[model samples]
Target: MANDGLSAGAAARRLGVAVTTLRTWHQRYGLGPSRHEPGHHRRYTVEDMVRLQVMQRLTAQGVSPAEAAAWARRAPSDASLSGGSPDASGGSPELTAADLAGFPSAAPHPGASGRSGVSSDVAGGSADPVDSVPAARVGDGEGGAPADLAGGAPADLAGATPAGLVGSAPAGGGQTIPLGPRANPAARGLARAAMRLDGPSMRYIIEAAVTGRGVILAWIHVIMPVLIGIGERYEATARFIEVEHLLSRTVTEVLAAVPRPPRDREPRTLLAAADEEQHTLPLEALAAALAEQGVPTRLLGARVPSQALLDAVNRTGPVVVVLWSQLPGSGSIDQLERIQAVPHPPLILAAAGPGWPVEGLPPTVTTLGDLASAVRLIARATSD
Candidate 1:
């Protein structure tokens, strides 16, 4: 056997079992270490360790060690176990598609047919927790329960089948099956538009919009890039208007659907504006972003008179002020400094857009280019 082979004692230590147990099984059950070399010590591969662990979990649940060992010995050789496909370890493999193919019908539950006395069907029915619980309820923070792997509720029954199974079972009363975040054509279109805008700008906007779903990778690699490409076409030529319009509409709808974070119950407030700033898109985007982060923002909308902003801040006692001038004109920075001087002025002043010149922006104010920075700055201001 190879010298790398673990001694029986070493194998037992690795498996957290007594060495005597390992020797007893090896001697009696014919599971003795393999003698890779004619007269040398026997060796065991890492796969053997995993099989042992699986066997251990089973035995702890009242299975006889002999039966569990038998299952482990047969599992590696069983083609039904998916050809012992490589797993994350790169040593012990993942089950092959062929292996999983026989599941759901044949396996019912793992080791269901074994003599361990455990039932194959859950709750004596066809339902699995993946289907029985509401997708939201699964991870809905009530008591820290984890949601199912699929995220939302079960797949659509219309699409459910042996070859193409979809929706799971309905949770509770069985009258309503909540629709999970499955792909919606309209939502995808909006994502496409945001994608076209591209860059960090579109990304920040979409991240704020889709808060609950763990679709970050999908957004970055697929959706955002495509959206950015479309946006580039629009800026390069007017041919993308129709697509842009569709994207904008879908984004608005989807954003509207996302549950707004509960407003801070404390009297603290915030006032934001796009002063004489025709670029209201970024401002609206920021306002929505703030709301998602739990700030109560009163958006003065686009093109507010300078005097009106000063008065509103005074009346609202807002803790912070955010201004966006997409096309900052001459002396706009001076005008912002004047706003910062208002009585008992808000703790933070954030200015974005093109109107304000970079030079001479006051020390009291934060100049931001996109939503992400604005969120961080606002959060810091609030905490302080």
Candidate 2:
């Protein structure tokens, strides 16, 4: 077929994606056939096919469809789509993560994984990961929150975005997490993908962020705002728990994929969700963020019982132990009291997540306010 183009069915077959999916991509993302003739239907040019392939592969790798579309929209002509030689064409040959989202990209780092690494190219290890994420500022306004600020925990999400869409329904359909008018394009892309439960699109956006901006920036600027916005939606309508769960699972997968601290360096930080507490995404973020700085943490993961937590602490003998709680009921004071009462308590006993009471009974316990502050504090506390 000449550059005149391939039919939708043919394009679908070639890309190995369904025609309906192709339609969705075209309608939702503007990744449609660009070639037209006098009497026939529009056909997908080679470039269009190439763009669709990019969208498909990225989504399959756990990137959200909407975000994949964003990248696809600006994709280079003849972009590598599996087994063909791409004929380089008109646009910039290279597309930076910043270019896709209108944000700054991290310098390439030898230490970070390709797209999966918690990469940071800053020298001297002095650059703050949280500080490096670009602002989510929609536009300059007195009422808008500055974009450079980072969110710490679920409780710290008030700083995530400038506007909240508490009761608003989305433009196309059912519901949406409220986004500011000037929301980061990447964030907007992520929100659209999550709303549609487009898991691959979400992963692509996040993994791309992790690859281009490091774990902390990815979470702070891309994943965190969507989370808080969705949580607000759930609060208002009591719906979309599935959306929340899918997004969280995707985040957990990506964060877990971040390279761990070297095996030679023993893990000195112990992380666990409080008893009966199921929320641990924040803790996962902390673990990955710490790992970015070459710090190892033994994450006990969600809903660890008090006894099991204590047993792990005793076994690991970590220098710092961080307990996470996402709600008040699960953020019990007794857990802290008992941990403090352990025969060998970690040097730093930290309370994380928003579930814990600010005024607590345990004197030795310290509250972790947000992701960056937690990472910064724990890395320092357990410095070898």
> Which candidate has the top score in lDDT?
2
User: Going through the candidates in order, what is the number of backbone clashes in each?
Assistant: 25, 16
| C-alpha RMSD in Å of predicted model 2 compared with the true structure | 10.1
Which residue ranges in model 2 land beyond 4 Å of their true spot? 1-18, 24-45, 51-174
Superposition error at 127 for model 2 (Å)? 19
lDDT for residue 245 in candidate 2, whole number 0-100: 69
Count clashing pairs, candidate 2: 16
Model 1 bad stretches (over 4 Å) = 1-228, 261-271
Worst 10 residues of 1 by lDDT: 114-123
Residue-wise C-alpha lDDT for candidate 2, range 350-376, written one tens digit per residue: 876545665754777886654566778
Q: List RMSD in Å for every model shown.
A: 22.5, 10.1
Give the whole-model CA lDDT for all candidates, comma-separated.
0.40, 0.59
